[model samples]
Target: MSESPISHLKFSTILSKLRAGINASDLHGSLTGYLCAGGKATEDTWGEALALDFTAEGIQDNPAFPQFFRQTRAQLDDVEFGFVPMLPADAAALETRAEALVDWCRGFLGGVGLAGAGKRGNELSADAREIVKDFATIASSNLDVSGKEEDETALVEVIEFVRVGVLLLHSELAPASSPRPATSPTSRSLH
Candidate 1:
């Protein structure tokens, strides 16, 4: 996949641009979670769901946000999202970086709950359940990547893992769009 448009953005910058105080990961997770959970098509419902986490801000109606929503949907709907999960590459402080990741996972799980992913059958697939459990573990556990090289390696691996799991779940939950059948033309009669 092409280098993600969002790759250049530091997690902080993304949050600012989106006018959302929530961590970038969580915001992304919420959006993805809602879509995967079979949330409705109305943009308002998506906005409201995001608001469940940030009541006051409520996902601004500004151009950037719409663009973000559009882009996110496109990514998910296309070949696959590649699941970057909104972590910052340049965060100088390890703790801060870890905190952002944890917040993101928390937000993602919250989004899943809000979207009611498993509410239908009251069950999540085994794979999905494992993924959720992993996310929960990641959210609560300490992140120590060891040395610089190892940290980079670990981060890359985790990103890949998260991307794959999310994509699989998305595919399972959100059916691809199909063309609408042509409607029959109205009959006209002349005397």
Candidate 2:
């Protein structure tokens, strides 16, 4: 399907709407459960933080995509973000920097993939799900997922759910283009 003419709408707005629609209380409760179940490193906290931030901030900058970066940073912070306590060159900072790069790349790719899918249609496509899966994989790889860890699986699922949910919400909220007026000077010009 042709891309909807919803140029005036912002993707951030759509994401916020979708996040708001979700059961936050339920999500938080679930996260707590996961955390109690040894999923300390799960991304649920980060996802919650980022989703909240997105709702609070909306889209500050559109073309520059600062909202996206800012929201991404919010999520990153929950993961001991950017090596918080020290300046660059410290081991923690170095790890944070590396992680940030990976996270940013994954986030961008997921966003782009979602946007492409949105342009194509309203319904979620397999390709779109694959893109989200790729996002989850990237997030999972950040930790030790090779050992059959339950925490890792839970974390990845949360991240993917948030990503997909955000994309789906944004597309749903996009506004249809304004309808053009029915009459024009040319229409009345005929003698």
Candidate 3:
């Protein structure tokens, strides 16, 4: 019943204006993934980790992105388990929302990979490994929906699983209290 920490519509509009070539859900997922993998929670570091060229014309100094970045970091660090992926509202079509979830998972996987989480695979607990595996499957699966109530319920369950899984990853991977340096953004391809 609480309002979403970030408004998907407003965030999506900001991305559209910036021509960021990514949806809001995916971007938020990437941010979450990066943070979970111990990346610094700064606009520059996030952009660098994701290889996003914020210096490109209108992308730099965008007021919305910094707010989004801070809000996501706070949600992940919140003790009350408030983290949620930025996806379409429940009023949206089931298929549309599902696709966004898929995109979000993909982005999350990419972010973790970029943050060198793969190198720490041996350190992850069994549950964390399973969570990563499940996220990978979700990211790759072609979810076919019939718009049935059961299908909606299943989607909700999967989303909740993702939310908890991310929290686990963050707790296990992020350093206890170390400051990370911000890397310079490069022109590498995100794919």
The prediction achieving the highest TM-score against the true structure is: 3
User: How well does each candidate superpose onto the true structure, as a TM-score?
Assistant: 0.71, 0.23, 0.87
Which regions in candidate 1 have their CA more than 4 angstroms from the true location? 1-11, 17-19, 42-45, 52-61, 80-83, 90-96, 120-122, 176-191
Q: Please, what is the whole-model Cα lDDT of each candidate in the order they appear?
A: 0.60, 0.33, 0.80
Q: What is the full ranking by TM-score, best candidate first?
A: 3, 1, 2
Q: Write the per-residue lDDT of candidate 3 for residues 1-191, one digit (tens) a residue.
A: 54345599898988898888888999988888988898765865678768877776777787777778888888877767777988999999999999999999999999998888999999987777778888888898788999999999989988877887787788788856223322122222111
lDDT of 1 at 176: 52
lDDT by residue for model 2 over 1-191, one digit each (tens)?
52322111244245446554423222222222222112223233334423333334532322223333333333323322211111112232334433433454344443333334334434544444444455445544564233345644544454444433333322332212112211111111101
| lDDT string, candidate 1, 1-191, tens digits | 63346542554575676556565667777787777656654444566755544333534544445555666676666543434566666545555666667777777777777777756433656666667677777767678655477776666566566666666666666655311221222221110
What is the clash count for each candidate, in the order shown? 0, 0, 0
Q: Against the true structure, candidate 3 has what lDDT?
A: 0.80
